[model samples]
Every structure is written in C-alpha cells, then in structure tokens.
Target: MYVEGLLSSLTRVKKARSLRAASWDTTGRNNDAWNIEPNETRVLADIKGPGCINHIWMTQRDGYRNVLLRAFWDDEEHPSVLCPLGDFFGLGNEIVNSYDSLLFSASTAGNNQFNTGCALNCYVQMPFNKSARIELVNEGDEMHRQYFYIDYELYEQPLDDEVAYFHTQFRRENPCDGWGHEIRVNTPEANIVNAERLAWDNNYLILEAEGRGHYIGCNLSITNFQGTWWGEGDDMIWVDGYKWPPDLHGTGSEDYLNQAWGMQPNAFRHNGSSIYEPDTDGYQTSYVFHLENPVRFEKEIRATIEHGHGNHLRNETSSVAYWYQLEPHKPFGILPVQQRKPVLRGEDGGWLINETAQTQQAEPTLNDEMKQLKAQWAEKQKTEA
Candidate 1:
C-alpha cells in the first residue's frame, strides 16, 4: 500500500493540473482567463499540482504591448521559480517577485490590446524534470494569432554535476506584420562568469554564458528587416563603460580617450563612426573582446551588435567602452573555445563571420549583495552535499 501510494503521488505530480473555468477570470471580467487592456496589470492563477512544476503558458489578446510574463512556484517559501522575462535574453532584468501569475501590458499607444480579438500566446517550460503548462484562447472576433510552445525537462542530475542546467526550446508562429517577438532566459542575479557573442556567416548571433553554478546560452536569428537594406550580417560588442560621441568631428576635444583609440587604425575600429567605403573595396572583418572576470552584479549595458549591411556599408559605431575585467588580454584572437562549434551551426543558417575568444581574470572585488548570494548558494550546495 505504501509503495502504491508513493507511485500514485508521483503520477499525480507528473501530470499537469490546470485552472478550472469557474476560476478563469476571478480578478477581472469573465473573458475567459486574464483579460488585460492597454495598461500593465498583474494577474494570478493558483497552480495546483504535485512534484516540481516547470512549465507556464500565456495567451494574450490581439494588439498587446510591453508584455512581461513571469512565473513563481510554491516551493520552500514560494520563492520565484522563473526569471523575469526581461532579464532572460540580456534585454532587461526587472524582478517581479510574486507567487501569483505573470505580468502583462499593452503598448504605449493603448491601441494594442491582448486576447481581445485573437489569442496571443506565450509559454514558459522547465527543461529539467519539473513541468508546467498554461494556455490561453480567445473567443472574441479579432484577427491575430500568436502561439508558442516551450518545453522543459529536469534531469535527475545536472550535466556537469557541479551546476544546475535548464535547457529551453521556444517555437513561435506569428502571421501578422510589424509584430515583435523574442525568447529570453534570465538569471535572477548576475553571476555570468564569462559571456561571449559570435557571428556565424552573417546570419545568427550565439550568446553563451559560463560560470560556477549556472550557464546560460541562446541563439538569436536575424529574420526581418525594417529601416534600411537587409541581408546576412556581422556581430559586434559594446562594453559597459565606453561612450561614443554623437558627432565626432564637431566634438570639443579631439583628444578624448576614444578619439585617441580611434586614431590608431588597427585591424578593427574601437570608436568613432565610419562608413564602409564601398569604393575603397571594403572587405569583411571580425571583431572580438573578452573580459577577465564574470559580471556578478546587476548592471545594464550593451554587450555586442551584429552589423547587417552590404559591402559599401556605413554608419557603424561603438557607443559604450568596456574595461577588461581581466588584465591586458588581447581583443582580437581566435574566437573563444566554446563558440567555435556553435558558430558553425549559425553559419549553416547564413551569417558569414569569424570567431575570436579571449580569456583573462577579472578584478577580485565583488559587491556586498553578490557576496551574500554567493554565500547563500554555497550553503545550498553544502546542504545538498
């Protein structure tokens, strides 16, 4: 009987539990599930399931804007189980620590609404062992359809055995024009020991992160074109500290640090704006930089940019300057070790670019919060051990 009970419990936990129709719109109008308008609103749905729940599905009305989705599970004290949608893709990190449902909003114009006419769907799934799934459907008369599926599975043991690995697969189909879409993976606290971006044959950008306790990785494909011409593209990086003057020639002091760096025409240009002198027969070039230490604290900065233009391209500039967290490591070298294979994968998709990886040690000084988190993670390690 005891064995049967345990097996039943495991089976119950493994199966997904969903919200009943009676509780669909407990907080708002009876529009089936959460009905959000042109403004940002937080909604909650009680998730009841056994075992570690690891997936979430979100469906929005048509014309949604600034849509932010998050998930929190009932684990030891209801700690947040998923990273904020913003921080997931190096886009933005805003912590919305609530045990309820995720956050959603319409665009600034208030013209775009979610789940009104057609369904706009977003999903979050854990790729370890735990699984959670949420889905939204629109019963109204709108002409938009956005649907995505995120698969999450948990391994009994981590890949490296030292850190936990969360593998995510996101697939989306949007038939509307001028609509924006992105898939993000966020780490609540920044402990990215090292991050690298590689351009493969001018088609995709592979973002890789590595460090103790966690590793975040993603590949972003260049699909649409808006402002200017479009084709396969190259990749670029922007450090935190650097600043690019708007108008270089009109600037007061030509002796600016970046100006000085720009004066030296090495294999690559560090600062200032320059156009691809098509008449000059501009050839392809690869740029790479590596910081010595991992970024442990929360900071907003542009890390890299992928230049997508024809041979005679212009208007390329680096705004922010980055200081090597590690000592005088070379900026231009063969792409880092982990990026080579992935670069090939990207090239298969059509981005033509080289790879360079830099390795160095960053300064040892860490902020108080980072130190505290490290300590807590360490304690958790000890308990698990």
Candidate 2:
C-alpha cells in the first residue's frame, strides 16, 4: 500500500519535465502550474535533490483569496510527522493558515536586498541523501543589503513512535553596514534561549544556542548595517515538537514576568530603539532542525518575504519553503529541564511543592488507571487458577 501511494504521488506531477532544469521563468507565476486540488487530492513531484520524492499539496479557498502549500516526504504515511514548507502558524489543532501572498521575482544587479515594492526569486531544492543549499541575492535597495540565513535539520527515533524532533539554526549576514537584525520564531509555543555570537568561519557568521520543544522559537535581525560588506553571520537553534510557556501564550502577547522568554542581549534595535518586533515584511529566512541521538532525521526550511521592507509594520508577500526527513517509530515526550523559575505557593498541607519534589511526582489519573487495571488483571488470574 505504501509503495502504491508513493508511486501514485510521483506520477501525479504533470509538469515534471519542465522542472528538470533550473529555470527562473518556470517559478512563482502562471508558469508554475502545479496544483494539488480538485480530483487530484495529492500532488507529488520529483525534483533534483537528495530525497527520493517531494509531495506538494495545494489548497485554495474563499474564492481563491487564500492558497496553501503543504510539502512533506513522499515516503511517509503520516505526512504531519514532517515539518511543512509554508506559513504554518496557528493553534496546534487548527489547519495552519497560508501566507497572504507568495510570488517569485528576479534581479541581475548582484546582491538582491529586500526593499519596499521589491519582488523576490525563490524556490525549493530537495536532494536525495544530501543537504540542500539555497542562493539569494539582494537587488532592490542597496541600503537593505543585509541577508539572514536559517537552516533546519529534522530527525526521529525508533523506540517511541509518537513525535518527531527538530534541531534548527539561524545565520545573519550584513553586506552593507553594521545593522541590527531581529530573529522571530512565528509559532507561539516555542522555548528559545542561549543566544550568543561565536567565532566566524568560512565566510559564515556563526551564532550558537540551544532550544528544545515545539513552542521554543528564536530570531536574529540586523540593526545598523555599517561598512561590513558580506562577511559571516551568527547562528541559533530550534528544537521542534516540544511546547513551552511562551508558545502557549500565542502571538504578540507580552509577559513582563517572563522577560527571559523574549529576545536575549536585548541591546540592539532596528531604528536605535530597544524593542523587538516580529518581521511581517516579505524577506527571506531559512530554518533547519535535526533530531539527533536515539533517532536521526533532518528537516530543512526556507522562509522568504516576497514583497516589501521592514518599516516596523506588517506586510504581505511572505512565504515559507521547506523540506523534511521522515523516519518512523521515533520516541518523543522526553521533557527538557526547565530553565525558568517555577511558580511557588505557601504550603498549607494537601501537596507540598518544591522543585525536586514536584519533579518526582508521577502523572495523575493515567498512571492511577494503569495501576488499577494491573491489579484487576492479577486478581482475575488468581481466581481462574
């Protein structure tokens, strides 16, 4: 059955021959005419990449006011186990709403920096058994020549089969000047931390940080782009499938008590102000997260802002592009050590709570039910004997 599904998805791409070569004219516009809608519920395409096949599902609704791009591994039965390549932000239960606008553009003027009214040239590259790299050039405004790179690696395990883990990193490069860049994780439920600048290597700015769980998110934005003309950039990590408190709060809800939940260093600003706002403008951001240890799977993501510049306001023309590593039978739900201060209360009996004591407590109801069931089975066996 799985083999049949895989073959069906592969043969579903009607325009496979057109995409054999790297052609900008074949992307983002009417020329990119692959849709997974109507009678063809599933759309699959084979691209020149490290993967056997890539599955793409296109959904349109409300008189075509909305369009969605859903991509996953063609080999996996459970597509949700893989990270999707598009604006996938919303309550955990609901379908992830698509980006308001997604288009592709090109420029011959070397570095294609993002600016107001500037279009972008973007696409996804999935390689079989190898890592994929995306190239971006700044063309619009020279003042915004700064670019950010985010890479994601997704992995899985064999013991437990419920969840998939992701390890992601971000890198920012300033080509024109020393500007401050802000990195924002769109998902509300992400635990983000350990942001710092490390040593540079191979013309890439290396920033290192660690985060676990789903809602843990991170971002890096250039504040003042000075005389630095494309050196290296910084990096950060995103661990998926784990949920934290900040992610529970949803988007734009500020918690003063949880200052650590916000951006670290808190020193640089876009316009010399100490405020960190999410980038709604259409710019390119990449993400990669890999689940290491126990199981090994890798996921790669690329997000590009298609239209305008950052004026500290929201704009359309943004889209997310991604690829995934799918491995079945991976164990999940191993919680990481909490880094924030726990909520405490004066003990008046009932349950005395301390950090160590609280950690020792077993899960309620579920554990009790299992214990009762075991006791009942034991008694029934004894009676039968």
Candidate 3:
C-alpha cells in the first residue's frame, strides 16, 4: 500500500495546517547529524497541539537500548511513550537488519559491507488536545549523531474528548528461566502438559494498563539458545478484571504475532518477521499492528504472553507494545543503561552477538574514549549509590 505522498489524504485534507521540524543546521557544510552529548536529554519536539502527529523519522549512530526516547501528551508529567530509540521502531536489540511494516520500519545501508549507515522511520498517528513533547536522552558512553524529521498536522478544531492518546512502552527480561534441555518436548506435547500450567502466574508483560482504549499491536524479538522452538507459548490478553479464562487467548506466540507455522525474516507492509540472524543462530524479530482487529477495553487491559508453554523455555526477550489509552497511564519501568543492555547466561561479563555488536562477522572494537567513558560512568554510579 504505497501512499502517493502528493496525493495522499494527509495533504488532501482541506483547511489544515501542516508543519515540519527537522535538524537542519544553520551552516549547510555540517548540517546533518545532531551531536547529542552523553547523558544529555535532547528535546526533539515541543509543540502546542489540538492536532495530530502524522509521521516521525529518525536515525542515530548509537546502540538501541542505550539511548532512551520518551514522550508526554497534554502537559502530563508522566510520559505516554518510553522505550529504546531503536526498539521503539521495531529494531530491538539495536540490530538494524532492515525491516519494513505499516507503522514501523528500519534499515541499514551497505548491508553486507562494513560501516553501514542506518535509517529508521515510523508512522503512528498521534492526537492530542493541549500539547505534545518528545525527548531523547543518550545513556550510552559516547556522543550520538542523530538526524530526524517530525511531520505533523495542526487542525482548526480541538480533538474530540473521547479520543485516546497514543502510548508505547518497552519491557524485557533476558534469559528467562527455562526448564533444562533434557526435559524439552515438542509443541503439541508441551501444550497439553502445560495447558493448566499456562496460568498467568508467570508471563511476559507486553502492555499492562488501567484505561479505556484499544491496543494497536507490538513488536517482539527473541534470542534463544535452546534447540526447541519458543512459539509454543500462547498469547493471553486479560481485559477488565478477567480472572477465570482471559477474554482473549491465542494458540501460540507466532499465532499471536499474526504468523503461522514458523516465522521467516520477511518484512511485509503490515505484519511479518523483521530480523532473522544467519550469523547468530536462534534469533528472530516479529511485528504485528492490529488495525481491523484491534482489541478494545473499557477499563483495563493486560497484554501478555508466555515465553514458553508452562514457562518451560528460557531465552532473551524484548518488546515494545503500542496502543491508544486514556490519560494517566500505568507506570513503565525505566531501567538504567546497564540493566537495559542485554546480557548472556553464566557469569560472563560481555554482550552476546546483537545489533550493537555483530562481532561474529567483524570485530566490534570500541575506541579509547568510549572505553574510558564507560569505566568512569560505572565508577561514578557505584559511588553515588
């Protein structure tokens, strides 16, 4: 569904004011990337709106989980959106294996070569009554060079009181507890045995909130070391105080993400796999945006999934859930930089092969500045604590 930009409904709207905010430097010679200093919070957009954000596009040379992106709507102290910059665009784990979907898409240049450039884009319509502010804070060790464009529409009239605000939140639990490989079983057997055990006592939280709105969708990425496929887990969504048998439940992880059988790294216009690691085995990224089948909620919604049926499979999982909900959202965790970064099993003090470090294909050597800065930051934090 390629939108003919010039003829799209966006520009065709009668009597609406359109605006663009870009990082265009005053001097054309060095006008590209916005050099965002480490530990600095950059205000990306601050605009009064009774309008809607039509599209947002950005790219930066920084690790995904390292740089945090947040947004506040209608002058609320609490942000409506909070997640890793890359993860926010369905590029979790900071690995930019180019992917494209309806609302989110990202790609890296020179795919097979070294020193690849990155491109990220998102198109989620956000409506607000009073105002909207977006911020990006660099939590990485070095300064990040960011380039962005925020496109929005200002309407003549205020938004309807019943309209919901867009919200997105990220969550992760690396290396979730898994039963030993010796006990690993097939999907059918696992489901039957884990049926009752698939209770909500232990499940990955995709989106949890007390509000009235329908969920749009989510992007889920998994890094598994075990040989057993992790799709045995089911999607269980509880709406409005569901206790016995949730209001919505799916057969498996792939089913919930709107894929059948196994998943391939095919990035489609709406729902499909984003990344499939060939160099690193057992890594895959999937995304789905619910347009026609969006789940509605009157009071609350708990979007969750079992990482493995009966919580038997263990692996690294990261996700960003998207939806539009009432004001005053439930709190989203703001993990420290170190905690946000992915970790491996055992006591090894290093990151596994990920978007940030495709070291398996090439050496991911950090310069002296970054090494020293990370060390200094760690020491400073220890002292402060």
Candidate 4:
C-alpha cells in the first residue's frame, strides 16, 4: 500500500528552512517567540522557489482575529493567501478548541490544558517554481507574541509548471443583504432573471478566481440573531463560464458538507461541525476538506450561496476559502477588521490571559505512534538484557 517515490532514491538533497523568533541571539533559551508590535508587518517566510512547503506550525497569544496572515507565491505583488491567522488554519471563531483533520488541526499543548494558547499545524503542500513570500500582520491595539516554523523541501526534481499555487481568502457579511417580510426593490425585475428566483443577486460569495485549479474546501462560521434556521440556504458554485444557477448546486448548508438534519458539535476526521456557541440563538462552525474530492475548474470559478431560501433570511456569516491555482493568480481583498469580526449571539467571548496546566485535572495522553514506539523500545531493552 505504501510504495516509495523517485525522491526516495535520490542520493543527495538540500533543505532550507527558518524558525523565526524575536530573540534569535538567545540560542533557544530565554526568548523564542517574536513579540509583534501593533501595525507591524513581520515577514515569516521569504524562500527561493524550486521548493514546496510541506508543513507549517505556529503558536500565538491573544488577539487571534487581530493577527492577519498572508502569503504570496511566485514572487507575486499581491498575496495569494490572506485571512486571520486563526481562521486560516480552521480556527474560525478565533477561540481554540482541539480538533483534528487531515490537512489542518490545532491542539492545547498541555494535554488538553490551556497552558499553550494553541499549537497549530497545517499540512497543505504549497509548491512554487519561482519564489514564496509569507507575512504576519498585527493589527490589534496591542502587541502579541507569535512563534512559527516553516518546514519545506528543496526538491531534487524541478517543480512542474502545472503545479498550482495555494491560496486562501476571507469574507464576512453581517446580516447579509436580504429581503425580509418587507421588500424594497421591485419584485418583477428581481424575478425576471428566471421567472422565479431564490436570490435576486445578493448571494454570499466565498471565492471568485480565474485560473486552472481545484478547490480545497472552506471553513464556515455563522451566528444567527433570528429564530430561523441559518442553514436554509444552499451552496452554489459557478465554474468556468457558467452564469446564474451555478454548475454545482447544493441542497442545504448542512447537506452541502454532508451533514444532515441540523448541525451538531463534533470533530470528525474529514468533515463535521465543531463549535456551537455560548448561545443557542444561532452560533455554529463547520468545516469540510475536499481532500479526496476537490472541485476542479479550468478557466474561472465563482463560489457562493444564499443567506436563506431566496436571500430572505438575515444572519452573520464568515468564511475562509482554500484553493490552488496557476501563477499570477487574481488578487483578492481582505475586509477591514471592523467588518471582519463576527456578530456573536450575546456578549463577546473573552479568553483567560494566564492559563496553567493546573486547571486541567486529567492527565494528557500520548498519541498512538508515540505509544507504539515506547512499547517497541521497552521490548528491545528486554531482549538486549
């Protein structure tokens, strides 16, 4: 089942990497993480091409949404990946709860304890033939500490020209432009498109890109102030040159991600709803990775969905769309912090500044791989004796 690749036969290879921090002179002793000042743009990675990033790890303090992450591929002027640091790696609500997925996941370092705010990991392979640039911007009123590691492989084989570049974009709409009980615009003009229309034009757009690549999936978070079900809307995607009534139409919000009935709180490996809120008034977070079945498009792609049946419901929705496209990809805009923040059902949720391992009563458990290694080592010792 596990066959070796040509790279495995290579005799010689070179690796280039950087573990950026505040005090590089400390020699991994006193200060290891960088304290990013407000409004400061910290260049995390500026690496030569003919390489692919295999892994990325990061840990940070408060102001999750206040910290923005952007990456530009092939020495592009604009960023190919841009989103709040937390949300970019599937921590949509800005609050970290341990969840596992194949491509992205985060964990509390001290065995489910809050000792480490969040130790994040991403396994998305981003290959570039020319160059790659990554930066972190602190836009909060105060500074915060950030530690990160970018692990990449300088390939023996030159990266293929068809290799797509990675991209992530963020969008948010508070009380999406919708028609409630009272309609302001003329109904005939709105309905004229297709005789009868579910949404005149106010569909929530997730991503619109022009290139040849496949979608990797997206992270979705929503807060409903109304009593109605937030998932009544359907997911619509227009690929290539298709117009309205997108080429790919989903049944419902939950059904689109393969969830049924209603959303529930669970961290499944591939897809599942993770965060439901401090208020039942309508707080939800769900993510689905199309790792096995990515949506492919050749020329252009426009992904969207309605807020409700016909853009009739009003709710706050935010998302992070991930995809891979050719070089010189279309640039996207990141919404301002004032608009990017989610509208909670109740008061804003605050996190503990100083969390300790003492708060967690249960002992941390070792992963299966570690446990297997330990057992093998013990057995080897007995045989050596």
Q: Which candidate has the highest lDDT of all?
A: 3
Per-residue C-alpha lDDT of model 4 across residues 174-258, encoded as one tens digit per residue: 6566544122122321121211133324567788899899997888887665444676567888789666657788877787767
- Answer with 1 or 3, whichever has the higher lDDT: 3
- When sorted by lDDT, best at the front, the candidate numbers are 3, 4, 1, 2
Look at candidate 1 and tell me the lDDT of residue 16.
41
Which segments of model 1 are wrong by more than 4 Å? 1-31, 37-40, 45-51, 72-124, 127-229, 235-305, 309-385
**Candidate 2: where are CA atoms >4 Å away?**
1-44, 47-67, 80-125, 129-326, 329-385
lDDT of 1 at 107: 20
CA lDDT for candidate 1: 0.25
CA RMSD per model (angstroms) = 22.3, 22.4, 11.9, 17.2
Clashing pairs in 3: 95-355
Alpha carbon lDDT of each predicted model? 0.25, 0.23, 0.73, 0.69
Please name the candidate that would achieve the greatest TM-score relative to the true structure: 3
Q: TM-score of the candidate numbered 1? A: 0.29
